[model samples]
Target: MKHNRKLNIFLIIIIIVSIIPLTSCIKDNVQPISKTEYMLGTICTITVYDNKPESVIDKAFARIKEIENKMSVNKPGTELDAVADAAGKNFVKVSKDTFYVLKKGKYYSEQSSGAFDITVGPLVKLWGIGTDNARLPSQSEIDEKKSLINYKDLLLDEKDSKVMLKRQGMSLDLGGIAKGYSADEAARILKENGVKHAIVNLGGNILAINTNTNGKPWNIGVQDPFKTRGDPAGGLNVTNKTVVTSGIYERYFEKNGKKYHHILNPFTGYPMDNNLASVTLVTDVSIDADAMTKNIFYLGVDKGMDYVNKKNGLQAIFITKDKKVYVTDGLKGNFQITNSSFKLMDKK
Candidate 1:
């Protein structure tokens, strides 16, 4: 009886030790706090994998809404609208957030040599590409709007944080870069709230806050521009980085057997007629990645590759209509093509 009692005590100790780890595993696998909202004209999702309460995610979403309210062109009485309303009149003071985005937009506009301009708002509103009233405008209408599409006319009074449009009809539509900024802001909120790992996705502007719950890099799927959403042509492993794609498939309308995308050319006041279907930029900052997409796409595959290779700490992938995947030298080994239909090109 004494021997049996000793064996029973040993077995109980082993069982309790095993169950301790099991409880910890259960806690680790608790469903991450995920929240989704539609603001800024796109689906925004903030997912946290830690034990943090849902308030953290809500705070992130709130930050995005604040940014949208400040910079949204569709919303009247917004800071962006105030600036546009005062175009060619007087400089309007804007919030620090608005001014910061405008400054970044102008910098990229100049860097891309006006291939991507923040002042393309006039042409964007005329075409109404993503709106219900989208239609093709006459040649004269396009030319008239194109004249107001120069980034040089966007005057920034840095000292006062005031902005003015040199032309009366010029508008500032941040559709190109606002979401990226919002995503970054959301990530900031999550981090400040002690979220160690999270995914902040504002439409296609995907930002990974940190590694996944598994302590590995997050896997971000590259949208197949030719197919519907969720169909990935490839996948990229990213950690604490953002993956932004500027593709013709994102926003477009069909008219009389022809398809017109939203990424308009500031120079010609028309959709960019390049063979490239999409351009994906991988970087640490979502705002930079967001605006750079248009600039790189405008340059096409060859020049775009050259532009990306010249820059440090930046990588880009250009997917051409021919189904050839051209990745920058930095992303050569990092990018993997999942779809057999699309082939990865060899380095030149």
Candidate 2:
């Protein structure tokens, strides 16, 4: 039998704010080559402004599909699913790529003190937030899954390149970071193809390859969380950065007039209740930006700002439910407020 995943239960994938080329409407001297495909359960696009061959774009998407096949828990017989099926039994040796991602996932899970747990698969399945099975689980069910949700239980052997989930019921979901990793891989493929400039968008995990053909930074619109999708609260100028946002509005379900979002708290095993409407992370690595959105959201606005402020390369734009916005030091000069409704607040 085959497993058919409509929402993938563990798909942390969401279309956050997207990048908009400032001169997108203006015709360029040289036309850019682009391709869009539905992969990783999301629409992905690769646009190369260097007039690279269509084969290069195909290669990038092919790499993304390869990553999806290896890391996606939705697919049966995948390396990740095989490890999950054998959890608490024995170590399952995996490919170098899968092992590396698992190692990185564990690292972030530890850094966030289990707040961004990669082992939240059980909890995710219980709620089924984005799938046809979407429903509120009973208190006992939530507790049971929560008990199985522990990042510390995921063991990795570097020498053998094997992984083991300490509990039999535990599952691994890389949806949180897999898309970002894929976007990074796509960008690398374009760069390797000698394409000087491109934009890799893996369902809104935006990675700007290089500066624009005009030698200017790419303009990325930060979505107004309270407003429509294309509405921008502000814009960011960047050369080589990945932008990702996680918000309550991205995915949700309403039952009995109350809404349940997909961003589950590792501690409570429920939707996170916070003042933040959205948290957009700007970093050089797409995977970090993707995982950091959830990690920073776990910290809330104040502590999240403190964490990003101290980081050497990471910057954040936090929008609260009250419509207040705050940007880290690195983006203060590069980010411009374009909407009057959004008040840029001082980081305290």
Model 2 Cα shift for residue 257 (angstroms):
2.1
Please give the range of 10 consecutive residues that has the lowest summed lDDT in model 2. 8-17
Whole-model lDDT per candidate: 0.81, 0.82
For residue 234, model 1's alpha carbon misses the true position, in angstroms, by: 0.8
TM-score, cand. 1: 0.90
Model 1, range 104-133, lDDT digits (tens) per residue?
Answer: 999999998998899999899998886766
- Give one clash count per candidate, in the order shown: 0, 0
Give the alpha carbon lDDT tens digit for every residue of 1-348 in model 2: 112234532332233324456445223666888776778766677888886679999999999999999998667789988888899999999998899888989999999998899999999888877566778889999999999999999999999999999889999888788988998898898899998888887754888987888888889888777653456788888888898878765566788878787889979989988898899999999988887788899899889998998888999999998889988888888888888988898876
Model 1 ranges with Cα > 4 A deviation: 1-28
Candidate 2, lDDT over the whole model: 0.82
